[model samples]
Target: MAEKAPKEMSFLDHLEELRWLLVRSTIAILVLASLSFFISDFIFEKILFGPKDPNFITYRFFCSISQSFGLEDVEICDAKMPFIIQNTSMGGQVSFLIWTCITAGFIIGFPYILWEVWKFISPALYAKEKKYAGAFVIVSSLLFFLGVLFGYFIITPLSVYFFGSFNASPEIVNEFNLESYTSMIKTSTIACGLLFELPIIIYFLTKMGLVSASFLRKYRKYALVIVLIVAAIITPPDVISQIIVTIPIMALYEISILISAVVGKKELMESTSK
Candidate 1:
């Protein structure tokens, strides 16, 4: 038997559908977050504090890279990082656990959220368009995870190293608040994960006629500037670090342009055929 097509929905019905989707997504997040609570110890101790140690994998890799240049006294190979983490408030840890689980929930539940979002949007898309759902979820999830890894290994470590090693004077000691430290990690991971969705965003924008390949190409230089600025903001104050971070972002932009162009051409062809 053929599947029954979804009925055309009124505006209120659409809103109701969206509300349910959101409710479901939230439930999925909370469920995953609850699961995360059990593993909070591992998340807190190993992954969160790992970068603070000089012997962390990322630091060791960077030190290895630096040594290849025969730079013996490179900052990355330091004996110890120069900061300590502390909790300033009574509810600090309780607050941290709740927020951390929520963050993990969001990350882990991202695929389900995308599935819900696709269900909402699928009614509006053509049969052919609906077929890309799997691709959309997989590609987007992969991009987000890649961005998270990049932020953790490259951006987070670099930021940690820069701030941890920085001292105004010998008299001033850098003591990082637990909340502040976690915020940095969360921001770095989540922000980069979202940023890596640029190509996907452009694809949709192009479909909606809000952007085009020509426009993206024309503003390439401006986009490059913006990319460099974002790289500088996230990375430590160094040319090499900025370039290292900028490369993947620039590639994403290029991918966005390509995606936009493909989407544009497909739309144009469809209109011409009609």
Candidate 2:
């Protein structure tokens, strides 16, 4: 039996395909987020607000590290976050829950979302590249999750402790809104997750001839300034916390440089052979 000809996809056809991909990704996120409704108590009391407590694991670890270095009275160990999380609006609590669940859903469903995105882009790749679909999803997901953990465990804790406790004066007390608190967590986690995709982004940009390793190297100093600025922005105004956040990001940038170099090498080899 003869097979029918494959229909050539137009611009609108591609847009339609993207729309379906987004729908599937959204469903995946919502479904996973919905499951958190069963564990709302744990999510709010323990996981979401874990960084606010002095006894959180990140605090304890930093305390031990500080003590080991002979630094007296580590802030993380002794400091109590002197702030109250209150709801200002009538639906503030309800809205917070919804947003929290949605954020959690996106983070949890990240891998599935990556799968959908890869499906959309896979047709553009060569057969050899297509074989890397599994690796791409796994590595990208792992990096994202790692970034999320880093933000939650390190950056969030430090920021929470610093801002929650810091008083400009003895008169001004910190009364944090519920929405504001969740925004900090959501922004840090999501931002870090996206930032950690630097290497992957660089690899593809190199492949597409949009960027090269030389370009990255040329602007390494500028990237350093930008990284430091980002670290300072997301983290507390302390040198230590900023340094901790900056290290991983700088490492990712370096790794991106290496990835770009390898991709360029591969493309050059392929071209030379032809």
Candidate 3:
């Protein structure tokens, strides 16, 4: 006997399901955030402020690279970040702690959130596709975390180094607000995480017949320009930093094109067989 397909849901039912999904995801995030409060000091000191240190891992790695190539005069090999982070308002510290925990929670609970999203959409999938739920969640979560690490290690350090060292005049000292500093860190990590989803996004778009490998190839130049623009937006104004950011993103775009091609090929074969 064959298994029956899932019954179609009405609009109201779909909305109700989506509402519960949000509720569950929110609860998970809050729980994780609450747990994070216990380790707030560690997060602030080690994770958030790590990039600000001259001896940070990223800085050391780049310094080694510069030394290995005999580029002894590179600023990263010797310069220090000169900016200080200050909270301007009485409630600022309290607010920053709360938001930072929430951000941490979201990052930690990303897999659960993806699972909830998978559940919300699974009813519409065929049984074969539904069986791949574990793979979907795992792959998406892996990609997201990779993106986060890339942003934290590569983008954050470069931005901090560049902006902190830049001076219009020797008289002007760099004192970044606490909010501004944390915001930069958060934006860099989250943006890169989402940006790293390009291949997955292409897979879905190809499945829905909305995008094609040829389309991506045809617009390769435009995509490069867009990638450069996005890199510039995320990194500092320096050419080297911008180039560093652009490299991985362009690689992701190229991978997306390949993913789209593979998906299209599979769909074509399936269609012909049917």
Top lDDT hit: 3
Positional deviation of residue 182's Cα in model 2 after best superposition, in angstroms: 0.5
**Each model's number of backbone clashes?**
0, 0, 0
Name the candidate, 1 or 3, with the larger lDDT value. 3
Clashing pairs in 1: none
Query: What are the lDDT figures for the candidates, one per model?
Result: 0.87, 0.85, 0.89
Over 1-274, each residue of candidate 1 has an lDDT whose tens digit, in order, gives 2233467889999999999999999999999999999999999988889889888887777667667767667766773688999999999999999999999999998888988988998888877778889999999999989989998888898888878887889999999999999999999999999989899899989999999999999999998999888777755554666787889989999999999999999989888877
Give the candidate order by descending lDDT.
3, 1, 2
Off by over 4 Å in 2: 1-8, 230-240
Candidate 1 stretches with Cα past 4 Å from truth are 1-6, 233-238
Which 10 residues in a row give candidate 1 its minimum summed lDDT? 1-10
Instruction: Judge candidate 2 against the unseen true structure and give its global Cα lDDT, from 0 to 1.
Output: 0.85
Candidate 3 stretches with Cα past 4 Å from truth are 1-4, 229-244
* Alpha-carbon deviation at 67 in model 2, angstroms: 1.6
**Residue 203 lDDT (model 2):** 90
Q: Per-residue alpha-carbon lDDT of model 3 for 161-260, expressed as tens digits? A: 8788889999999999999999999999998998898898999899999999999999999989987887776555446656777888889999999999
Query: Worst ten-residue run, lDDT, model 3?
Result: 233-242
